[model samples]
Target: MEIDYSHIKVIGFDADDTLWVNETYFREAEEEVGKLLSHYETPNKIDQELYKMELKNLGTYGYGVKGFVLSMIELAVELSNGKVSNSIISDILNIGKRMLNKPIELLEGVEEVLKTLSKDYRLILATKGDLLDQERKLEKSGLIDYFHHIEVLSEKQEYNYSRLLKHLDIKPSEFLMVGNSLKSDILPLINIGSEAIHVPFHTTWQHEKVSENETNGVDYKTVYSLLEILKFFKNN
Candidate 1:
């Protein structure tokens, strides 16, 4: 397939699954949550309730393991009619703590790609999550030096990208974003006249999943892996 980077000056990368293992841990934690709450309801029902809790609390608490753990605590109370034990609550908290301590496992070619791109274009780590958590991961990844800036957004929307570009003093047409979520990474940039590439992760948060109808005529390209991007550049 053909592509263009002729006018691209600044490139943005998404963290979590795009750069390393992320959604996989969330999946594991959810299963553990199910087991912990199994006495009150079936695992499937537990999952459904948890998803609803997450949605209801998204605006209140935003994203990250802290919000997730709190949601789980609230769900436990509701499902058990406030009879859930302290031990169970402690287990849920521990789950979040363990997730916080997870090692940064970079995806294949992450360093090589960043190192190569930094030489020719300004790169930014633009991902959405809790500020403190994201910083820890970026520091741990040891890829911090390659980025010219780091933006940990509360949300990824058209307006958000527009404001970010304005802050960076870059034009939409000159910015290119690459990441795993179509909802968060690709469509919004395209909507704002910036370019995007969809590098899909094997696991996506349900909240970040988008429908075909939402993407019908929008222009973007999808690559299977992160490093495949180097081929699009002139001097790679």
Candidate 2:
């Protein structure tokens, strides 16, 4: 089925893995945390338990390196029966700090895609994470100038997208979302009657994984890279 994008006036981009290197760092941090907690449990067990902790605390900590770090600490204490050492706790804190301070490495053709598309369509950044951290990344990305509006959402759901569209005074048909997560970025927009394009990253967070049944018959385009998306709007 060939979809039409002629009506899309505002293009929304997801900031993290979709535009820059994000989930990769999370994976690395998880590996580091696994090693740090190996004394309490096997590496695989630590990894599994840490993911569970993150999910358990999602509502409390929301999403970001801060939340992730807190989850790691909680897991350390729990797995070690409150006997986890201060030095190990300190190591966990440093891991989060390192992740927070990591440089923004933009994905291939991110600038060219944004630069070209911004010339014709209104481009807005719609990403969910720690507002401060997201802002810091945008500022450092040097791509902030291309966006007309920036939204750091607490969550990405159908209602959230609907509210965003209403706030922007644009119909769902007039908006298009591009991102990496099928759960947060693609499914929500599709459910809200908006268009979305999936540009997957090499690594995905476990929380973002969606089953095939969830995507069955969903009418969204999956492009291999950001540069490939330019073709869809070539005639515009």
Candidate 3:
């Protein structure tokens, strides 16, 4: 099937792993947490149980470093049978704080791609996470001015995108989303009749992983890097 870009007037970009280094930090934090909880369980079991706890707490905590940190603390409590030490919990808190304070490291070609695309299309930042955390990264990124709109969504389902497009008065055919997650970025946009481009990151959160069969019939393009998207747009 052919994919079209001529009708795309508004282009949405996903933050976090799509634009900068994110999942890597989360992985590092998880490793530290595993070691901190090593007295209670093996590293493998810690990871597995942590993932399960994340799923359970997703509704209450939502996505972001804060949620992840809370999950780590919860897992520590559970694995230790309420015998978790205050120092270990404090260390976990420090991990989350460090993540929140980490510098925003943009991926290669990100600014160049944004610069080129902004000149041709109405660019928007449509990432999901804790609002303040996302805002902090965007501010630090120095790429905020390149976008005409900024939206930090709580979720990225088809309906969420649909509501967003409607709010912005953008037609599905006129919208395009670029991101690293197939589940949140590609599938939702395709299902809502919008175009999407997938730029996979080296590290992905387990929650965002999707089976090949799940994306079998999805209409989207997968590119190796953000720069490749520049070739897809037509010159006005």
Candidates in order, TM-scores: namely 0.98, 0.98, 0.97
Q: Model 2's lDDT to the true fold?
A: 0.94
| Candidate 3 off by > 4 Å | 1-3, 234-236
Model 1, stretches more than 4 Å misplaced? none
Model 1 agreement with the true structure over 6-40: per-residue lDDT tens digits: 88999999998999999999999999999999999
Task: Kindly indicate the candidate among 1 and 3 with the higher TM-score.
Answer: 1
Clashes in predicted model 3: 0
Q: If ranked by lDDT, best first, what sequence of candidates would result?
A: 2, 1, 3
The ten-residue window of minimal lDDT in model 2 covers 1-10
Report the C-alpha displacement of residue 236, candidate 3, in angstroms. 4.9
Candidate 3: TM-score?
Answer: 0.97
Residue 206 lDDT in candidate 2: 88
Write down the TM-score for model 1. 0.98
